[model samples]
Target chain A: MTRQALPPGTLDDTDRQLLNLLQEPLPLTAHPFAAAAAATGLAEDEAVARVARLREVGAITRFGPFLDAAAMGGAFCLCAMAVPPGRFDEVVTLVNAHPEVAHNYERQHRLNMWFVLACERPEGIARTAARIGKETGLKVHLFPKLKEFFIGFRVVA
Target chain B: MKLDATDRRLLAATASGLPLTLRPFAEVGTWLGLPEAEVIARFAALQAAGIVRRIAVAPNHYAVGMVANGMSVWDVADEAAEDLGARIGALGFVSHCYLRPRSLPDWPYNLFAMIHGTSRDEVEAKRQQVAAILGPALRASDILYSTRILKKTGMRLVEGG
Candidate 1:
């Protein structure tokens, strides 16, 4: 399907409702769409259509289950790097290719490049790093999350 | 998003972590002193209101062997940022990507993309690749490595007694 281009900052109430729903899905139930439609005061078809539209517009990145890797005995850490002026996209592409890499972001700092990699075990993290290094030819500074005080947040629009 | 009492109760129960069981909601309902159906209903409402983003597991990267992680910030040309941001978002390594209003005199970066790696060295290498793609148009960029994680929890939709 040809993707429709979204206008800048063009979001209606239904669009907002869709974005909000994608962030946190309700418990999977027999009538999930019906439940959501009731809550949003829209028809079930409208609720479903809104979500699909959001995905099409690129507003909602991914709508899926959030897993607790820690509970599954997986190891993860937050790391960052300082990239020169001219290689952000190339580096991002290389880093994103790794399966273990889960969450990546750009923050305000000298060590500008940052991402999180979650692996089956703690040892696998190092190997993933080495592979990324080999692929990109840049020194990756491994900053394992030493302590986790808190980890989840939601932005209400 | 204004949450009702039912919404509040549901959020309070599932905010930290989901019950790992076959009947998770039933278990959660028992803990919260509510009926399973009610808990389920409110949860659905909370999600629709945009109050509860997702009920999912937060992975421990360290435990999984992803020892290194970082927040990669970029200074892309204002004109090209939306396009570049979309491309970065599509990358698997990038979990979160957004365009924040640049903080003048404090933070100059307008676009941010996060990438995760097992080791710090690995993340650094990824950064170089991103830099190459950005080319000469980027004005400045930085990586704020997480020294400590203060708090991570779902928003409390209900008020206290």
Candidate 2:
């Protein structure tokens, strides 16, 4: 079925329901959409459409399962860089190309560029950082997470 | 999303990492002593409730060689913050972007974007790109570099101490 295009900030009750669903997807099941619709009191088609619209509008980045790298014996670290004027885009492209890098961001500060990297092994993280520093010709600060305080929080809006 | 005991157990077990096996779900089911079908069913319920987000693999930037990272906070004009944020989010380098209410007396930046790079220079380059896009409207910004690795895990829906 063709879904109606979503208007800006025009989230209805159904839309909200869909958002709630996307926030937490059920286990991989045969009829996942149907299961979600049953819980949200919406039709399967409506649930699917709403999810699609939400993703299209960027409210939801993706609809998939989460992975635990540590469990897989992979290592990860959080790092940041200080970007000078007129060079942030070029740097980001370089960083994103690496297979280990997962998420990157632009923040407000001297150390303005931040990203997280996951590696097959723990030692690989530092090696990759050194490579980045050499390749980019800049000081890349490696901030390996020391102690995890708060893991993940959700916005209940 | 409202969660039951079984769902809670599933989340707690899988929050950190899924079992590294051919049938990860089957392994989880074995641990929980439930049938695979039941385990799968509860997971669906949790998702429908909006308690579980996406289930996808996140690349470890520090592993594959791209290493620079930062938490960029921007003091964007109230009127244009959302527009600029959406634009920044569209950038491939940016993984997560959101609008947060600035804290009083300490934090004035309402928009946050994450950028990653292979090196400090690379990240700086991306920062410049974002700055150019915002032009002069961006008053100030800060990049808080992570100092140490900490606990990263998925949220547990069931209430527990």
Candidate 3:
């Protein structure tokens, strides 16, 4: 199922190394790229340029502080809805109308539609879910994570 | 750590991204009228409080050929959920692992691990690894393949300004 998107030589060894390395926690120092460069045996300028190029090519989505909304008195909730196939488009329109919805994906399941709601306050999750329910006339199941297991997660780049 | 007005300003400024420069922190500071040292200090403090998970890179799996993203959910025994969850999360291929509430008859999976691969078969293979890790504790499992993206407007800053 792997479709070769780029040429075989598109991503060099250094590029792959940086991609994997950058996934780990970055230093909080003023010159983070400088630190990264030193660790990866690259010049600071080159590291910056290569990262920028990766971003330009959409090989990476973002590189910055990953904030936990819950720590900032905010909340992120995973929500799902089993929308009828015929009303799927209309329901999506109504659900996506709320600014709280970060992203919505249609999945293969009876409870097909899944999305995440990032809210400033925890209460906002319930409020937005209720509003979406009323608007779409569908039951929205909120699966706010009860516990998150910290993983040594590394994206396959 | 409670976020003050200045902190919120800093967050809102860098929410989109941290400027990619030799002195990226200083560049972010310039936007919020803070010195580089103070910006660094505040971030350090916030990070200590677990507010900032990390400063890192996020690879777009889709763009990198790991386009097959599967939400492989497992119904593990409740008593052993947390223990098994930790094991599942530690897998190199598992991106996110969360122990969530099972919605009874409708849904019985409590352990959710996001598995990504170059193809669905690869994803399935990874899922099998997870199931194997789960072993007898795994009662049932299923994977939901995303059919489409209904919307992708990205996250927003809540109204507080």
Say which candidate scores most in DockQ: 3
Residue-level lDDT of model 3, residues B1-161, one tens digit each, is 66788878887887878876788888888888889999999888888989788888888777677777889999999999999999988888888899988886788889899988888999999899888888998899999998888887776665463
Model 1 C-alpha lDDT per residue in residues A1-157, reported as the tens digit of each score:
1122245465677656545454555556634456656778887777767765655455543443343335324677655567664887788778878767776766445556667777777898899988887888876766553222122223222
Candidates 2 and 3 compared: the better one by DockQ is: 3
Q: What is the lDDT of candidate 1?
A: 0.60
Q: Candidate order by TM-score, highest to lowest? A: 3, 2, 1
For every prediction, compared with the true complex, DockQ reads: 0.05, 0.06, 0.62
Candidate lDDT (C-alpha), each? 0.60, 0.62, 0.84
Q: What order do you get sorting by lDDT, best first?
A: 3, 2, 1
Give the Cα error of residue B110 in candidate 1, in Å: 1.4
TM-score, model 2 to reference: 0.48
lDDT digits (tens) for residues A50-83 of candidate 2:
6666554545543445533343246777676787
TM-score of chain A of 1: 0.61
How high is the lDDT of residue B121 in model 1? 93
Q: Give lDDT tens digits, candidate 3, residues A1-157.
A: 1223555676787888889888988887767877668877999999999998888777777878887766767689999999999998888889888888999999999999999998888899999999999888888888889999866778766
Error of 2 at A130 (Å): 40
Q: Over 4 Å off in model 2, which ranges?
A: A1-157, B103-106, B147-158
lDDT of 1 at B59: 31
Best prediction by TM-score: 3
